[model samples]
Target: MEHQWVLLFQDAASVREILSHLIYLSFVLKDSPPLFVKLNVAIILEVLRYAQMHQLFPTFSLQTIVFFSLELVRVTTYEEALGQAINLQKSKLFCSRNTLDDLKNLIATTLGVRQVLGTCKYLGLPSMIGHSKHATFKFVKDRIWNKINSWSSRCLSQAGREVLIKSVLQSIPSYVMSIFLLPGSIINEIEKMLNFFWWGHNSANSRGLHWLSWERLSVPKVFGGMGVKGLKAFNMAMVGKHAWKLVSSLESLITRLLKAKYFPRSDYFGASIGHNPSYVWRSIWSAKDVIRRGFQWSIGTGEHIPVWDHPWISNVARILPSTHHHLEWPSITISDLLITPEKQWNMELINTFFDTVTARNIFNTRCFLW
Candidate 1:
């Protein structure tokens, strides 16, 4: 088994083939690892529970809201020995007879009371805003909200907040990626995904309860917001911890120490040896692509934070002209003089000529406008 598993994905073609079969391969991989099998069974069972819950009781389907809660438990449980038996038992309790009432009762016990008073869990005010359940964006007005006297506000239980963050971080990527994968104007229509079906937060006069209404906070800072991050951003923020491994990786004293003490190459899941990396390392790497997409922030030249008009990128006023630009600035191309100076001088004419020249020369772009 070791030898076969080792040889399974030895080449580029194999990696591509495996990626193509990622969904199927995931199912196949459940058997080999003894540790995760029990809990994975739990996850599969919960996934089914939620799916059925959604189908049967759309009105009461807070199931997907808490689904992330289960996933959070799975990833962080660390030791199968601690989680498997209890969680597995929880599944049986849920499916004892496969009736909605029994499932609801089981969920009530296993999930412990916080059954989300409003519509769905994700649709909750804080959750909708991409905040941890702990976050509460209250109206600066509203007699009820205004009644709270101090910024030194009481907060929700830290436990609930953490679970909220974990759930949102894990679930948002699939939505963001699926949106980007669509073609043409379909991407533009992605705003429909943000349409509000409902919004409410706990009415308790606690700090966390402040995030009740959608009116006070949601959009973004530029759109006049406190710039409270969304789930998509938080998800990347969480995934970024792993991505730092690949980016900050080095063969140094610190890395060696980290490897030896906390995550050894041998014992650690993600450590790379020759070709194969450890599982911990691989998970971080897998998350990199998602992080890359989630982490859209970047620093550009001239310390200019780009506006929507130039949000894609902004040019920096270079203190030191890069060698390639100062030295090799494609000086005076033959076509530069081919077009009449009058023609070249016209912005419209120049744009057409530049496009043709760039396309013909295989430059992909021609932004030179001296």
Candidate 2:
């Protein structure tokens, strides 16, 4: 009953073959012969209608579909996949290969795809050159430094400098910070640049003493410090957002990709930092603690929740008293307490297994039953 859409073709002829196979599959699944014939005819008519509405010859549209389909496939071997890309005519490849001369020559002569190196930009974010966190974010520091060097602080008022720092300089690394946990050194460099812009002499070469610490300045308005954004906390919050998305948006493409690559056998809540993970993946994993502190499960059927461990009951201590360690059934779920037909908590069972105070709390706790 499971159906999969495959895109291994570059022309209308391939699409026709696929459609014919689908029609045959439908016929095999349907019991009534007349209905089977009608279903096949309907599918063909719908395909024709789709082609007409899009103003494309049915065969021509196959190339467009093929182009889009490439996004879903992970290209492991560029040379092998190059033939298919060439056949499409509308597609090209930008490759990052190792320094083996034989392999490079083979790719250049046979595949003809454009070769690139570590400097390639993806979605405007530069690729990390190596494992060094500071070097990875050096460009972000350079960018902000250049901007500060270009501006003459002498001509601008204190208020103008503050406005520029908040609006312009702080925003230079906002995009990169969202994905990478920037090094403390890089953050200090950025803060120094901002500090120099705010308190230093107007000349780019002149130095000035900071009247206040960067940490104090980063505090909120209600606090004693200026309300400036701290790079480290902002980076953590941004990465934490991705962790939140992985839990809440299970069907999202990012969630699916991460799940497949990092935690195929387990859920996001139970995922660990596996061996040799990418820097981006490592940064996302680092936010797991933040996500766990804020997460609470609402009681539904509660079949998947552990009674003692899960943070389900609101306004109560998360774990039971250590004195109750002798009690068995550590892995029991809330669903085990429910009466089968009536779907209500078994009071006698609860009383038998728990102390008077514990039993009373369990009986009084509100359950969402979702």
Top lDDT model: 2
Top of the candidates by TM-score: 2
Error of 1 at 33 (Å): 2.7
Tens digits of lDDT, candidate 1, 1-370? 3343335434314223433332343357652244344444455446445545556435444333234333534554555545534343222222323345644554565444443333232322222222221122221122223222221122534444334323532243334332122122322222112211111222333223334333334456587743333434443445456455443565656456546654554422233433444333333444544544433223222122222112121132211112222243333232332334332333443344334443233232222332
Model 2, residue 73: distance off in Å is 11
- Candidate 2, clashing residue pairs? none
Model 1's lDDT to the true fold? 0.35
Q: What lDDT does candidate 1 reach at residue 293?
A: 40
- Give the runs in model 1 whose Cα sits over 4 Å from its true position: 1-32, 37-101, 119-125, 128-139, 143-370
What are the RMSD figures for all models against the true structure? 19.3, 10.9
